[model samples]
Target chain A: MKPEQKPDQQTLSSTFALRINGADLVILVLTIMLLFWVYNRLWFKQSSGKADYLVVQIDTQAPVQYPLNQKRLLELEGRKGKSIIEISQGKARFIHSACRNQFCVFHGWLSTPGDTTACLPNRISIAVKSHSVKDTEHFDALAGER
Target chain B: MQLHFTTRHDDHRIALLAALAISIHIIESAFPSPLPGIKPGLANVITLFCFIRYGWQTALQVSLLRVLISSLLLGSFLSPTFLLSLSGALLSLASLYIVQWPFRQHLKYQPTAIGYALIASISHICGQFLVAWYFFIPHPGLFKLLPVFITFAVLLGLLSGIITQLLINTDTAKI
Candidate 1:
């Protein structure tokens, strides 16, 4: 009889395994370097901006309020030219205006950074400016007195 | 006659391997991450196994099939997200293919698997950043959150690697 042939299964599996192992090693090293680069770019280096205060400007031709009150719904109603800025309840917003788009109305209220409302039709704008240190301290003193 | 028979056998082996890789991909996609874009990438473990057990061609097939099938199933086909997945998979596979040589001679399967998994994870993130820059964010500076991405990658990669190592250890023992 011809010499008995040992099954080649082990040889095949081992050969395949060795080839795969080699590929994996190369992938691992390259990935580590890439991750290091991403970490430095995305995480370690970030920007920080300071806080600001709020300002509101309204056109004289626009509607004016004798006295701004939270209790009133503060509707501009049918008045053609008017703008109103109201600050109460620890937040600020343009309560009502005669602008057609009403984007200023949609701005809602602002208590934080970069908040602004503008009625382009009436040439009125309300902006939240970065609060100075003195303003913050004064606000804090007012809170303490209360 | 013997050569033809061996070629047929190799073809069968490759088909079986591809099927196995797709199954793992399905399972990985079915589970959602708590974070919007995170995944354990359990499928990569199988791709790694195939890359180690068969060859680069098989690994490439597995990676492509996994991305295609997973994207289709997840309803992300034809979307930017699908493109991101494809880029990530290709980068990962390329990295794995390149690192296989040193791993075979000097490292145990566990360490090698861990190292490769980490590399794949990083490559995947880089691919994501490229896509985000092109399609979503215009400025590269917007991706300054690289630390957050890297931390997440390390944690997820370590977990995937550990699981893969355990499976490899068990499979080797059976053999």
Candidate 2:
């Protein structure tokens, strides 16, 4: 490779040639701050408290939401056939399904907020999300209005 | 007559740079990172510097040697972690080549060392993440980790780039 210019002689005078300038530093700082803010918001921000519910969706139908405090067995219609899901102790899973792989069954439990398990062949997806206290209070207010 | 394109001197230069990169790789691995997938990847500074000084081929040689030798030392050879490292190195090299292509041919806006570092680092993380997601985890939740990975990449990328720039500008960087 031909030497374009000797670093010792040419570079000293042109120190800023490849160096990060003030503008670049400012931009970098801003970008990092923005990213940290976003990451904190997405991953660290607690939604009132721990997740208190499980949402089960099958195919294109509306999702069925359940309070985690209650324990029950739910049967849902999947694309291929029916699936049996179990909810117990604020966690849920696919106990039985017609799908061949039974991947969802092996996926174990969904207990944490943002945890999800899905069996595509069966078209059933389950997610754990926080049900805020305000929504519960709103529901209670609606009942009182009646 | 066979034309000797790369001389004996070039081979020595390549070996020297590769050794420097390998040392840095092993040393960086010793430090524990707060996050599992987050690392400063200081060895990439050598790759970027070599690319600017010599060319892409030399840069590739140095990076691949570093990954291979370091993994062997770390006892992760042929393991899933080794595969991830290999993929990351290969993708970073490929991206470096693509990024420098225009600058090599056209007198377009000359990309700074930071540009090369940023592009290569991001591609490296992406390559590793894709392999991890597809082979190791295979979960949609893996996508959630992308933002953190990218943020770390950006931070480390800029840092390594500035260090490379300082080394180059100070005449301390040796090819």
Candidate 3:
């Protein structure tokens, strides 16, 4: 065998290795496993992420921002009367509302993104929110409500 | 006075391949990405071809030249985007060099384009993120994005690798 034939032998794989080799298979498997781990890690962080803040939106007024981790009480004047809210343990809740049925207060604690409670009659609402720019993704392919 | 530059056969090959890579780069840039810094990097197909057919030197020339010319055309020269591009190209080339170094003269296991692509793309994004976090955004929060970026790198890397393998395996690939 001439030395010139060696180059051709090398190019044989380049020219005719139509079937993927074992190395290619291994690399593909490893890459897919990596993607799986990364997806699990990132999606878990995303799904389990807690709210960092609370926003109180009064009727036709600028929403007031409050930290979730900070325990505090807020009494804001609404359309009809005062609505009181409380923040504690990284959760926010409507403590008292000047509504007929007290529905907002009974709605319980809000602790994640897209969680909210509103006193409809008083036109006041408090929402648990997180300041993550990565919330752009939807829950499912069908664009289910988050 | 007739002054001209002498060139090798490989030089013209580099020019042609670089032009091809640059065109692909420009067309790819027109795409809208779901997130910044994520791209198919289709131009790498040309670079990988040059690497497998010619050599690492040719691949390096084509990749670097593509980044430089494409950035200039895209009006991002000397900017952060250029920095990321240059860094990613350099780091991926270095990784390819190391990977090919072992199989230089061998009769044993041959690492295919898939392995090289996986290594190259992952290290490429790692280098880019290093530059981004260190020079541009020095925040611990940025590290949270590492897994996400790497995930995309793996996916895109596999895609480009399959394309490269097909190109290499084709009978007319010698051209």
Candidate 4:
């Protein structure tokens, strides 16, 4: 780097050096705002005053509703075998399953409305719901019917 | 008749960078993701490095070669995973190229490694999501995870950008 050289020309090092400048700080602020927005959206469901139950379905059977606030150890029968789900407080989780992988069991607890998990091999699935059955069509639309 | 092959200095540099990125990619794949389609993408530091210290063309070569070779090594070639990797790489590179256009005339104010990396990672994840939605799972339900993905992209992209900056500022980064 020659000190006496004219500053008119563009150099690679001068142009794209990753310094802590105003532009970087501005971007950082924008990213943080986006993160907060996403956090708020996800958090909205929990306190919507309607998130109270979970929907459990074995294979193509009609979905069954269970209150998330009620503590219960529920056993469900599927094609392969039986699975157990534990619901307590405002959260529910798969404690036991017939599948070898146990991905659903490892999925921990689901407490958010619209959250879902499935034991593909056992043909059992669970989804957290926030609305009444009459609004299930809207719910399914929101859930993408997955 | 004997065939002779020539390896230029640029070729050697590209190979070295691609190998570094591929190693990082392979190591990253070994980690279990809490959700599908989420990765730390530490390898992108190399891509960012190439883009800045070397040039756009060299960066492109390193990034693509890392994708191809890593897919082949991971045995996910031509699979959905590979497709996601390809789209992500292409989109990120394109974003960097486009983002770099205006500064071509000037030395200062060009978005540096931090800016470049943030855009690269964000576009990379979006490209992956688009591919996943279009080809594998068309469920809009998948989009429910968008916030989570974007959040990770932003956080990880910033971290990667910072790391790249630190890397370049080091004397040994001249390599």
Mind giving the per-residue lDDT tens digits that candidate 2 earns over B1-175? 8876656877888888888888998888889999887899899999998887788998888888888898899899988878889999899889878866856865345466776777778889989998876666654456678888888898798888878887677655344
True contacts kept of 2: 0.19
TM-scores, each model vs. reference: 0.53, 0.60, 0.64, 0.64
The prediction achieving the highest DockQ against the true structure is: 3
The DockQ-based order of candidates, best leading, equals 3, 1, 4, 2
Question: For residues A5-114, could you state the per-residue lDDT of candidate 3 as single tens digits?
Answer: 57767776676454556666776787778777866765555447688999889998988899988888999899989998999988999889898999998889888576
Docking class for model 3 is incorrect
Q: What is the lDDT of candidate 2?
A: 0.79
Model 3: how far residue B27 lies from native, Å? 1.6
Measured on C-alpha atoms, candidate 1 has an lDDT of: 0.62
Docking class of 2: incorrect
In model 2, what is the error at residue A113, expressed in angstroms? 13
Model 2 chain B, poorest ten-residue lDDT window? B102-111
**Model 4: runs farther than 4 Å from truth?**
A1-18, A36-146, B172-174
Candidate 3 regions off by >4 Å? A1-17, A45-70, A74-146, B139-148, B171-175
* Colliding pairs, model 4: none
lDDT of 1 by residue, A1-146 (tens): 89775658755554335223544565556656766876665456432433244454455554343222232233332335766666664356786788677888788875544445677777776654344322221222113421
Docking class of 4: incorrect
Question: Per-residue CA lDDT of candidate 2, range A65-141, in tens?
Answer: 88887899989888899899888887888899889999999999877666888989989899887755222212221
Ranking by lDDT: 4, 3, 2, 1
Q: Evaluate residue A131 in candidate 2 and report its C-alpha lDDT on the 0 to 100 scale.
A: 54
